[model samples]
Target chain A: MRQSRFGPKVAVAFSLALCWVLPIAAQVETEEWRFRPQLGLWFGPVTPVPGTHLTRILETSLGGGLFFRMNIPSNNLRFETGASYSYYTSPTIARLHSIPVYGALSYILPIHLPLTFQAKGGFGSNFLRNYPEGSRNWLPLGYLGFEASFPAGKVVNIGLRIDYYFVYEQHLRPPPNNPNYRLYNGHFLNFGLMVNFNLNR
Target chain B: MVKLRNILSFGALAVLGCTNELPLSDLLNNTMTLKLLGTYESNDPYGWLNLPVDDVITTSGVASSDPAIGGGSDLVNYVLNASTGLSVRPNDLKFYIDIAEIRIARGQGKAPGQPIPEYWSQFAISRQLLCSDYATAEPGRILQNCADQNGSSKLHEFFNGGFTYPAVDIEHGNYNHLGIYFRRFVTAPAVGFLGNGTFINATAPERTMVATFDNRSVYGMDVASLLQNNYGEAAAEPRMFPLQRKDLKLFVEAGHEPYVLEVRVFVKNNMMVHILQPAGGNAAVTYVAPIDWNTNHAYRDLFNGERQGGSLLMTARTYQPAKSGAIQFSAPATAGEYFGVTEAATMLTTPNMVLPLAATRGTNTRITNLPPGNYNVYRLCDKTRCSNASTPGGCDQAAGQDGYPETVAFCGQYTVSSGTTTNVPLALCSSACP
Candidate 1:
């Protein structure tokens, strides 16, 4: 039988709605909803597209991100989102800065222990700034990472994360008739320390 | 659990390795400098010889052998006043320098005589009047006025201060040679005296003859035949000094150390010569008098009619009937009568180089951020001239034609090292075509 393009989306949305409704119904009977507000320090190295003038102008430097999340009962999954900033040092003029907004789905491991592991996958839109004025680009990005967390107390969890980012292919417009212009696909790696507050507890 | 621990250890190592604390390559330390020392000598020992003025001739009154006929007094001293002829001096004169490839002298995978590829490899520098003081004046007026107002000086002193190339990154190695070329317009004065009864005055309409000293033209036949067989002389050639020095070695370093390479070049000015006069019987005396603003001080004695000395004697002066008996300074019947009267040969003396030119005193240029290495230095004639066998109707034999030949006159070898200053001294030939 043939299926409509929206059919899968509708089913996935219905399942997500049922999962949230069931968790809410159970929370009403059990007496609480689960939410985690996280604060983190993110840092890593970022490389620009190679074989372009931008590579010569920009170099790998440290950058960071901060995030917040809300837990769902079904499969121990959570909705996660964050804002991040990265920097690239320049030798000629000014430094380059990249700020991105990220959204992701995260799942905690089912291991029965005081310490837990989590995995996340997300998409982001990055806005690069502070380059040669009037030369800026918006990069569509993807993220994947792993985190290990341990409960410090009933209300807080301390975690460490290693995130890898992939920026989609893009091109920088060069002056007319210049043969040096090239397409860029950037890769960045970040490490962070997170402090999560269990608001529902 | 053990596998997870191993993965974490590898990840940690990779993160540490990707950190940005690694050092960047240190290419900023390479540099080379070519400085002008303003000290040079002439290859010819007996340099420029002064020719006599046009008016001094052998008549029944003043014989050629007379001590007072063509001696030191024959050189007329005119103070180049406002009304002097406009054509008595060259309009513009400049120096051109060229450097061949700089390469590693001795190293693995390094070849000799191969120059480093650089966009700034070939460039030119000129000596021109940049100040506004003489902006509106003619070249002759400017030169005369500057010399008169600023005391005796060289042309470069009143014009260009010095030349400095922008910073360049060169490879580290032993260099083969650096090439240098020079060109200028020399003005030879043909002055004489006109006389009315009992009154003698410097003549009008003094001829300022212009000559070019181009090394390429000196060896044009040699270079042209190399390019093509049966090639004719070029129709038009640039006014350039006919001297070149080539194949100088310079060494460059690969560190941030500073180096200063000074190139001392000597120019021969055709303005230094001696004039003789008969003091008494059978003995002619010459004085060591250089032109008003020249730096050469070498002197020559003209006696017994040797080296065309007989034609350089002065015969006429402001008529003083009581002291000197001359009714009038008669004009010469033929131009050849005054063989060496008006022309003077100028040379760069050893003493002048030791004492710097007064006008260009205390001028130095500092160039930073150049790659250090060995370079070959050369000097040659860089001018534009037409070929003799150029296609008819396709090429014109004008003075500034394209596809002109270049000639090398002087070539030598020197070395440049990092963190150390290298001085290269060179001498110009006294004769224009030597």
Candidate 2:
């Protein structure tokens, strides 16, 4: 009598999208959409939180990633699609090397003067390699980020990005009675310099 | 407005990420802890060594080698002559205990067929458990409930814990005999010292000889009397280590009531390796001797021809080794560890020259090709003892170290005759390093 997990997850996602649309539609601007290809780099530290097998033994590790993004700017709204390569390491066990390909939406804050702040959120699947016991799982990934950037030049902008990523991982056929082998969520946070190259320039 | 939306979105993701429960870490607490102590005694049935001849050394520092006229030339005779010391405890012993059943008898039965009352029944303790209820499962009951995860291979990591589940609260009445049924697989990192540091001119001051026991027949013993006993862990096959009354005690914690029955068992010299010589080979020509004992169990060396190298230190620069007398010995294979040897020289003309010698199993590693002089072999080790404090290798005696720290024992020393091959056979012993 096992039920499918797909239906409930889809229902919850649709509800979240509806909540987002009402407020976003009120501030929609009629500016023409402009497309730009960009390249970015980020580095930060990651830690396993409570409810993980490695929670007690795993040490904090510094991680880094690089991404190529396509940005379609329309007034206050910006649509982005990107593919990234992230790498992380632990002292005892585990090497988390993943490739996350995602589509995201960003909203520019209506603040005065020099610096511009953008709120970004995305959902995608992350393919991980070198997992514990050689487990290769493509985990569902979601991230929320905040970026503050100032124009470095007409062609490029140098800014700092803080992104928190969550990945859902499934157990690899463990003994059914032991709850210790259940599904867990892998978490990561990145805070580093992000330099974007505006392809239009 | 943007900051509020960002906070709400991040909070929702955080909730989704942290919804699962933490896995239990105390799964090992359910298994019983069986501590193995080594008791060395003459005429012990579990004894692996043939005999211990500690008092029969000649004044010349060589073991008296009487030629085999009729029933004499054997591994025990050859290897015993080269042994420095014997002990019950080895440097390391790791084995898997796949227990099937444990039964205790309340009465002393004269004949093997005499039936004794079961102790568990008298205490009203439940002996049967469901496989799904693994949280309270005893180590012996694992095979009864769950499928063997290692599958045919009984080699699995021993779960380390203090809590012995199926806690025995019953009193020790007339229960004098305890029988345990289990599957057999034991791995001992065999280490021994060869020469005494006494005679530097003829033999090494101390020489360490190291080997490993990947030999299944050498370490695997028949645990049960049942047919097809070697194949799997079944109730029909049972190996029993009868515990004496003195070894059984009633242990009660200081503030606790109801005395608990504690059974202490001693595993004898299971690591003792008997070195035997083949019957047809010429005593003088055949330098490589076959190592085994005549017993019910067959001994087969797995890692033959494995090359082992050790460092040799000469004690004195007096007698230089002549390019004539060769030291022929066999070094068994040890995987995943280091081997080292140091020797003191009483007759070396060169001052403190540390030479490297390699020994291979079933073959000869010639050291006679080196410069001629009297050389004293000092020490040999499976793991090198580093002199530098900063280097993170070798077993350290520092408090709270990772593993058990051990000292390298000095093997025996003997005078060497020129133009002859000296066979320094290695023996596995209970005591070492003194």
Candidate 3:
């Protein structure tokens, strides 16, 4: 069998979602979804592909983002939109600044206790800026991830979030004229702490 | 649930198939810098010497009386394999080559996700300009245009002999060999100052060194050989297509930029000397004396008369024009700290060869290539230090040179000749001279 590039990643995403939801299926159906507005902050490592120019020149530094989430009327369903910032610096002092804005459908797996879990999938555009060179472009990006949160108070929730992101970058310029340019399809994995405040509380 | 699983599987398979269309390396950070370094065998002084007509000869004091002298040679036989004179660096040096391609061979093991071994492959920085592109180009004309130290030339600078390429993509693997294909003709300016400060401004009759590759290496050729072989069609292609080196054992890893492709060319003992006789014929002499550029300001002063068949034959004195003379001086006095002691001593003059009037002590200072003329000398005496100059004596004598009178400032005048070096006497005295 020909191995798919995203075979392992899709399997992991599905398995995690199944593990968190299968046991709590009864809880998700018992109660109707209520409108809840949440503001969140997240920070974690931005890991590029292991053997890419990004990984070679840049560091696995922390990335941070702000997100807004609202539960829809559909049971265990929420619409999440967020903006993130990540930075990597090279040995030559060149820097890469990545900013991504995305919207995703998150499934809330409600359980009997205060603990809750969510599975998220999204597609967005990543704005990449290479410093010193001052070149910037927007690349197509997709990510699959899961988040686990616990209520801190009536208005605050804190937890950990991890995501596997894939970006497609293309170069159509012919060579000899532009010898240094090449195409890059980057893969990144991010994991960090997430703090969310319930705006509707 | 079934529909979601089917969609995820379809998306994963689609992405996998899409990625296989593009050629991708398993390793990243494979960018390597390639450098072409031209080095010399020894730091020996080398330059050119003219004959018959006494012209300006540029040398960095290459020849010395003793064969064992450091950075010099009594004689460096071109025919003798063991005799290699010092090959000094050439000032304003530039080399031009036409590179056809550069390729590398991979190891026997198969690359990741590949069925067969990734064998010999071409890099992204390959297939540069070819030699046949310059078939109609002339070295003499090209050198005249490109040899300027601070000038730009597309034909000379950008025709692909550039010494360094900073970003060459090499895949991750082990390499066994590297093949470089370039032209046979290597062009460079023949005129430059040698290590011993001998300047060879040979621009009129000959100006460039157009050398050909005799063997696999291009090291043994000197200025004489380059001059002799300076002819031939410029753009002619040779029989050999490429030059190669084997057993590189080069390993390129992913996420590393350590690989460097370096090519070194040796240039040593490159100067030549041609003896010119007044009687219209040349004679061989054993062991030529070391010519001093500083001492012998005049070229004609090197030899009194012609020597024929190993016998002294004095010819009539040929009247040569006056040559430029020079002035030699002892070292200057060190500047003493005078910050708080005296405000008037702020502009203290440190003596050097160029400023001969400001005399020094200990080391010898010489000013060469000065036109023959007459010059005057004067001095200024301060409380702490005295200066020998060509102006009226000024005094700040609260503490410096207290007893010295104004009359002592007139250190007498000296003349510079075409054949001799003027040794000006400069001294600091507290008392007036009788």
Candidate 3 residues lying further than 4 Å off, grouped into runs, are A1-32, A109-115, A171-176, A179-181, B1-36, B39-434
The 10 consecutive residues of candidate 1 chain B with the worst lDDT sum are B335-344
Global lDDT of each model? 0.35, 0.35, 0.42
Give TM per candidate: 0.31, 0.32, 0.35
Model 1's DockQ? 0.03
Could you tell which candidate, 2 or 3, scores higher by DockQ?
Answer: 3
lDDT of 3 by residue, B1-434 (tens): 99999998765544333222222221232345564422210011112212111112213222321112122222122111132322232222333344555556644433567632134454523333312122212432333212332223332322222245333355455666665555432433222222222223323212322244322222111222111111121223221233444534455544322334544222111111222222222221211111111111111112322111101000000011235455564443222101100012122132210112122111224444334556544332322222212111221222223111112233445676777887755452113322
- Model 2 alpha-carbon miss at residue B104, Å: 40
Predicted structure with the largest TM-score when compared to the true one = 3
lDDT of 1 by residue, A84-195 (tens): 7877765333355767667888888898988889899998756555422323455567878788889898877887887766655343332332233234555656677767
Classify candidate 3 by CAPRI docking class: incorrect
Q: Compute DockQ for each candidate against the true complex.
A: 0.03, 0.01, 0.03
How badly does each model clash, as a count of residue pairs?
Answer: 74, 47, 20
Q: How would you encode candidate 2's per-residue C-alpha lDDT over B200-276 as one tens digit per residue? A: 22242112221111111222222212112221223332223221222121222221111223222222221333221
Candidate RMSDs in Å, in order, are 23.7, 26.9, 24.8
List the lowest-lDDT window of 10 residues for candidate 3 chain B: B310-319
